[model samples]
Target: MDTSRLLRTTTTVIAAAGLLLTGCTTGGSGKLQTAASSAQPSPDPTALRPYYEQKLTWRECGVPGFQCSTMKAPLDYANPGSGQDVDIAVSRRVATGPGKKLGSLVVNPGGPGGSGIGYLQAYAGIGYPAPVRARYDMVSFDPRGVQRSSPVECLTGPEMDKYTQVDQTPDDAAERAELVAAFKEFAAGCRARSERVLPHVSTVDAARDMDLLRGVLGDEKLNYVGASYGTFLGATYADLFPGRVGRLVLDGAMDPARPSLDLNRDQTAGFDTAFTSFAKDCAKQPDCPLGNGSPEEVGERLKDFFRKLDAQPVASGDPARPLGEALATTGVIAALYDESAWPQLREALRSAMNGDGAGLLALADSYYERGADGKYANLMFANAAVNCLDQPPAFSGPDAVDSALPSFEKASPVFGAGLAWAALNCAYWPVKATGTAKELVAKGAPPIVVVGTTRDPATPYRWAQALAGQLDSGTLLTYDGDGHTAYGRGSDCIDSAINRYLLEGKPPQDGTKC
Candidate 1:
């Protein structure tokens, strides 16, 4: 849960590469200027538009149940009158059932950069609850620098291998220097590879893109559901186009009013909280590896074990592969995303401590999406690019991170400053941020539901409260449990409440804790 926040002054906010954790860029007035481009930027398909506007066709593409279409909007919206066009890839699954159909519903699964098109095709278009699915034409697309539309790529497979293996929690000067190199190389790769598209991928730009998509789809109002970073995207759309909103739902929401360092620090604390919960449960189980002890004791033992591994690396049963900091940290990050995986995490740790690295490596592989053949997806690369583009990393240099260690360690004695410094990956982003933090008031928009899971590690629950508070028409629905999101993680009460809202536009009672 990234908290996904930025600090604001009056109505303006300092923009960086997305959410400033604690230092999301405060006290700056208009450092990053908003684009003054026209609001009607749609002539992008052709350099010479007015002359050829009459020639372009908008026929629907055949995709079984979906209605696919192509749209040309400005690659840069500020100059909508410009002839340079950016084609948008769009798809919609129209509702078909005995009951009357609702207009449309857009789904976003937050990475500030995840592929909405892929999410739609894989999950929302079909995996959404049947009743809700039958009433709305589900829609999705790849945002500017995302997949399918026009992706922002950075590293090759071999280069990426070195990048993911960088040690975050450096023990010696050599290790620390290695970490620095990794960060610099990653930033350099983006600047070198994605320079053309990096500067234009800000959240504001994406939100405006949404507004244009809303128009081309023939909808006067937009209905949507966003989670994690998606919450920030939805909130931004509401801020920029308050009047065009309809039935918006922001779950696993991010706070839109914090800086980068604080955001990451809070998440550090959150993971600590989750670890504490996991520890308590583990100690009560018979298979507990750290032995039967108090939760705090179990945590202390785990921390000591990690320290031991840091000093002397463990053999992970592979000749060229070793279980190092990156893999270990990722294993923990993955566990934090899903509560259902906690017991598995405990077992993984137990096995790892006994010279068996397979279990821990498996968890790490899932987080990194590593394959048996050693092939890796573009998830981390895209994540770093989108995140770095959204906001500057929380810290700028290794010295700064070193100085901030005490506080980060206090935040999580186990994770410590490594997680804090990991937040600094975007501090030196090649492109500048074009968007800033702002409370989306959606003053006259229909009631939007903001859902929160009590112990969600990736998107902290408190953020949902913050987002709900900012939106004038937002109501809170609490899922008193753990995990990144509550939707399909299996709580009848949570699912039913959200389903009712999407299917019937019936918001659950405010402050209703499930």
Candidate 2:
């Protein structure tokens, strides 16, 4: 039960290339400047000139037709002269040109942890519409504290396996204590292994890094596409450098206006909505595993299965690792990210119920970015790092989670308890939060497109609405469909609208429904 802000994009990446994977004001000279140049009213741009003026020497990476490079950004923006820098990993596929070239279209598949470079190489660079790709370079970067970018390391593969198995829904005081201990151990591991970058990995730091990247890339204005948590990051950039915004699209948006608890509860409800949609579709299938009365009945059946696993774990082909309640719940939530995964979920459920938990375990493994080599990627570590720094913990302790249970349960009977408990992980973070929940109204920015899926499981549609309304010039593009992000998930209307926006700088009409 990681933070709900975790993007479904990683699952998309896993399904595609098999790789596992957030603001402020305006300022000076409308030219590409240092990262911290215009972050404030009148900053000492000369101090950071080396970083902004540094050239990126892109070379062919392993990925065909793509180039990789590294950009340098200050480790701490508050004190640029500290001499510590984080090498941000970047990737790009230069425009295939049959049209006039637009500036770089930087893209992000939001995990706060998702590898933007992986997303670019795997999908965005190749799968994006040809016209848009022909006009603009498809670029992405693994933000600071993310994969290939001084990533935060917490636990070893085996330790993570044990951590994931920790009971999220504690039924007694002992279980609750165990949960807390697990969280403390996890936090301690982060502090011990990656303490230096932990406090500086806030969204603000990343946004400033983006500005530096923009300067290095020679892009006066950043044209971009960001999904899930990426939306929050892009919005933050717009708020900070409203005048530097080019054509921007934020799909599957998150509302920065909401507090952590509200976001967790909202995302829980969103998952319930996705599960109901999945269950309804399953009911129509002849071999629906949960049976066919109604969504609630199906949910109850699933809950019963989880309870059974809690009592006695099921075999998952690995003698050392068994399918427990936590992993099984993660597997189910993983499948709910995309409707195309529903059939796989059904089969996983059917097999799990019959005592073979291999399929569900595989799904859970993919969600965790655990490779066949028994190693885990830094996705989860960076996720907690950025999420915990971005806002205060949703729950101060077990008692706080208990107090919020009723509201969470009312929102999602199936996932409420686990998600509520999941919110408690940040409470034990070593560093206090540096960011506060606030509405981002990029007041002077140009029209930015915000895409929303009606039944997005991870980022609810209302969040998109809220974000669009918050931005002074945001235009809401609604996809009356399912899944997480709308733009590249097989919706021509959605894709075309975004493509048009990216290529021609013409956003769709406000309130347009696809």
Candidate 3:
């Protein structure tokens, strides 16, 4: 996963041609300005009042239990009257109350690109604890440039197929040039296809949009559960509107203070940690392909596999496209999200080592959400757009990457180089970053809960510790287990504490261990 993750999500929409989206700007200090710390509400500018006051008409859509709605937010909040509105796609499942209802409990499954509406409809609506689901209207909305919302588009399917296959670990000048061109091509395509919506899709802008959603939903205060990148988004919301915050849960939280380089390096180390755990578990299996080696040797063996794939891509049942190092690594990363996927990863790797790349390719395709028809979800496109606009580039060029290589390699000898190169993708972005890496205290907000799985591969546990320490009233819930987000993954302790927090406003004790 890029520090800017592609965990899971998708969407569709065309940006209007040649609209002026660059009026709003950031100082590019590489750190975001902290939101106002006071509990006092900020007055809404007159021109933007209409947006906050508009009535949303909800109608049934998608799964049977959910209602869908559309919202309009200014493409540029600074100039609300600009007449460029981006449609926000929202979905809700009304409370099936047996007790007093809580206004609304919004959930986000952190892609920076995850379709919040899809998450609501597919999992949060019906997947949450029935007791919790019974009292709060479960709601979610795709952020401005996510699925169903006015999404950002980049390359076509074939182009993306080509892009993902480009040799990430460049062995020669031609291969290095190909990697650079792939990043450039992707950046250029996004600019060409999404110029109007690109600049306004920053994290700050998305945070502002969440506030609008709160008012339009008639909630006096926002109740939110955000995981992964959503943690950053929700923290921004709480920081911006501390007075309007109710109970917020930031699970698998991110450390907003880390610059892109450190974030990526930490994440590279995170994947290394997760992979080591996987190797330990695999060694116990009778058919473990890694052959009971030490974790260090296992890592080198995996790296060796990747190098071999880079040299001679394996046939994946598709003649036009074979599984290369990039896709194989993505396949491995996808499995790291949840330990349940570990067995599948083991099988995939076993096959890949034997020269049949189909299983690994399938896993990679699933990670990218590519369909049999070769169409891709807008996940990666919007992920890059939001990420690029949130922070300055991690590396300016190949030379900069070379200089940073040792540190990254120290972070994760297996994944460092690829992730470092992946960071370079943002350097070529068309829009200047409008958000920054900054501490968020959300001073006046009610007690907020932050959950961290000890062996989480995406947003490491230390990030949760950092975020919890930063928030004035933040409490840390530790899950000494494996996987990404912990709440609904079968930890009674985690779920019970969070449930109590959301229901009775009784936050778990700080430093609570599950």
Best by lDDT: 2
Q: What is the C-alpha RMSD of each candidate to the true structure, in Å?
A: 8.5, 3.8, 6.3
Model 2 scores a C-alpha lDDT of 0.85
- List, residue by residue over 362-416, the lDDT tens digit for candidate 3: 8778777677899887878999999888888888999898898888788888888
Please list all clashing residue pairs in model 2, or write none if there are none.
22-233, 24-239, 24-240, 25-240
**Per-residue lDDT of candidate 1, residues 1-514 (tens digit):** 1112211110010001111011111121111112122222333333323322321233344335655555554556556555555555566677867578787788777775565665665567777888878888888766677654555677776676667667778777998788777777877887788776676676777776776666555567789988777888888788766778878888888887766777777777777777777778888888988777976788788877777767665777765566765676667666767666778888888778887777777777655546677765444556666666565567778888888899989988877666876876776677665544456676777888998888777677888999899988989999988767777667889889988888777999999999
Residue 8 displacement in candidate 2 (angstroms): 3.8
* Model 2 lDDT tens row, 1-514: 4545576463453543322221111222223453332223323566666777677777777767888877777787666657887878888899999988997999888888888887788788998888989999889889899878888999999999899999999999999999999999999999999999998898878887888888777888988888899999999889887888888899999999999999999999999999999989998899899998799999999999999999999999997889999999999999888898999999999999999999999998888888888898888999999999999889898999999999989888999989989989999999998888999998889999999999998999999999999999999999999888888888899888888888777889999998
Flag regions of model 2 displaced more than 4 Å: 10-43
163, model 1: CA deviation in Å?
1.3
The Cα RMSD in angstroms, rounded to one decimal, for candidate 2 relative to the true structure is 3.8
Q: Which segments of candidate 1 are over 4 A away from where they belong?
A: 1-71, 81-87, 371-373
lDDT score of residue 414 within candidate 1 = 77
Please give the lDDT score at residue 455 for candidate 2: 95
TM-score for each predicted model, relative to the true structure = 0.85, 0.95, 0.93
Clashes of 3: 2
Cα displacement (angstroms), candidate 2, residue 390, comes to 0.6
TM-score of 1: 0.85
